[model samples]
Target: MTTRTAEMLMAVVMGLFSVFLMWKSAELEIGWIPDEGPGGGAWPFWLSAIMLLCCVVTLFRWWRRATPESRSTVQFMDKNTRRINYITVGSLVALLVLTHIIGIYFSIFLFLLFYIRFVGRHSWLLTGILSVASPVFLFFFFEAMLKILLPKGYSEPLFYPLYQIIY
Candidate 1:
């Protein structure tokens, strides 16, 4: 497909998703309650609202624009670009799926290493640093500051003690 086609399609999909999020968030009540912070749906509601606005603006521009040059001209999806795009996106999706079985932080480390070293052809040193640092940063950020729980998956049993110490 042409680049315009892709962008248009993405706009449509994003708009639809934004609508869905707004609908769902509205059901949960986005407003904050007395003495309580924003409701469960506040973030999704506002974020989706912004997304919807942006999508409308994007679509309007696409609709009004004339030539390909007016937009961010997309170079033809050459073989290399296609391959790299596929590999990177595929790795991300695979990581998401695998996280249910393995864990989030672990999968991130593995995926980053694979994508950088194998797909993007970066150095081993870079891969090693990223693989280790990404998860460590996530552990501190999510667990320590946010106090949010992440899936440990199968690593739960093996890594629970580690989490107790870190978190």
Candidate 2:
């Protein structure tokens, strides 16, 4: 399949998976209790249901609008950037594998450093800024504002002080 079609099919599969998750979660008690807040998987279940619906809509629109011309181009992106693409995607895959193993901050830091330094061939200054900034932003956004706890493994305790302060 062409990349566009492959991507869309993957999205459809993801949507179906989300729907299955929502279905499974629905089998559990999902209502808010008196003392406790939302029951298990309230957000994920509902949000994923919404996402599944949206994906259905997207699939419908895509089916209606997609043309043979769109499928003709497999080289939508720059072929010369293959190495950069592989590096970037590899870093992301590694980050996913490492997120629970070493935690978010450390994994993201490593990923950012690799991308900026090796893939992007950027200056140390830019790499330093990005390596420091992105995780901090995500930490505050998820851990502080959303009151969600991410995995804290290996040297993740280093951010405990910041986490306590922000939270």
Candidate 3:
């Protein structure tokens, strides 16, 4: 399909999804409560509402061919780009599946290692720094500061020392 057609189709799908989100969120009370700062659904409902508006505007622009995105008939991707896209998407899926086995931090580290070292052809030093540092930063940000625990899977014990130090 042409880019314009694909854009319209995606916009329509997103618009429908936004509407569904808004409807579901409204069931939990979309407005603010007198005592509470905001109802459980307030944030989601408002965000979905905004998305719906953007989708509507996109649809209108496409209909009018007002923007280059709306007017373009370009093919989305060539074979090489498509192959690269598929590889990237496959790696991300692998990362997600690995998360269930090795845990989020380790999965993220592996992903960064693969992307930076192999796909990006970066220097080993840079790849090593990013792959190690990102997970550590994430651990500190989520576990130490926010008190949020990410999935640790079979590697839960590995974080005990870090947790002991932080706590």
Candidate 4:
């Protein structure tokens, strides 16, 4: 379909999704509690509200043909773009599957390695640095600092030594 059609469709779909999120979040308190800061649903509810507003603005602009994208009749995806989109989606699916089996850290490492080394055609040094550093940073940020344990799957035992150090 044309870019204009695609833009309008995405706006509508996202607007609906935002409304759904707002509804779900509103089931919990969206305002501040006396002892606690923001309520559990505050962030999600406000963010969804903003997203809905943005979607409304986008729809209005599209109706007026106020943006170049709204005016364009160009095809949304050429063959090369379609191929790239498929690859990205496939890679994401693989990441999720691998996360269930191998764990988030290793799966993310593999994902970053493939995307940086192959898809991005970056230098090996840069690729290696990023692939290693990203997972390490995530581990420290989530496990150490935030005290939130991400799924380790089959790789759970491997992190025992590090966990000992942290705890």
Best by lDDT: 4
Candidate 4 structure quality by residue, lDDT tens digits, 1-167: 89999999999999999999999999999999998789999999999999999999999999999989999999999889998899899999999999999999999999999999989999999999999999999999999999999998999999999999999
Query: Per-residue CA lDDT of candidate 3, range 49-150, in tens?
Result: 999999999999999998787788888676888888988999999999999999999999999999999999999999999999999999999999999999
- In angstroms, give how far residue 130 of model 2 lies from its true place: 1.4
Better of 2 and 4 by TM-score: 4
Tell me how candidate 2 scores on lDDT: 0.79
Model 1, TM vs. native:
0.56
lDDT of each: 0.85, 0.79, 0.93, 0.97
Q: Give the better candidate number (1 or 4) by TM-score.
A: 4
After superposing candidate 2, which stretches have Cα over 4 Å from the reference? Answer: 1-81
Estimate TM-scores for all models: 0.56, 0.50, 0.60, 0.60
Backbone clashes in model 4: 0
> Can you write out model 1's per-residue Cα lDDT over 1-167, one digit (the tens) per residue?
56777777888899999999899899886998879889888989999999999988888888887546336556548788898889878988999998999999889988988988887789999899989999988888888889897987887787667678875
Tell me each candidate's RMSD, in Å, in order.
7.0, 8.5, 5.4, 6.4
State, as a TM-score between 0 and 1, how close model 4 is to the true structure: 0.60
Winner by TM-score between candidate 3 and candidate 1 = 3
Model 2, residue 126: displacement in angstroms? Answer: 1.2
Better of 1 and 2 by lDDT: 1
Candidates, ranked, lDDT: 4, 3, 1, 2
- What is the C-alpha lDDT profile of model 2 across 45-146, one tens digit per residue? 888888898878767766765644335447445666776677778888999889878998889999999888877799999999999999888888888889
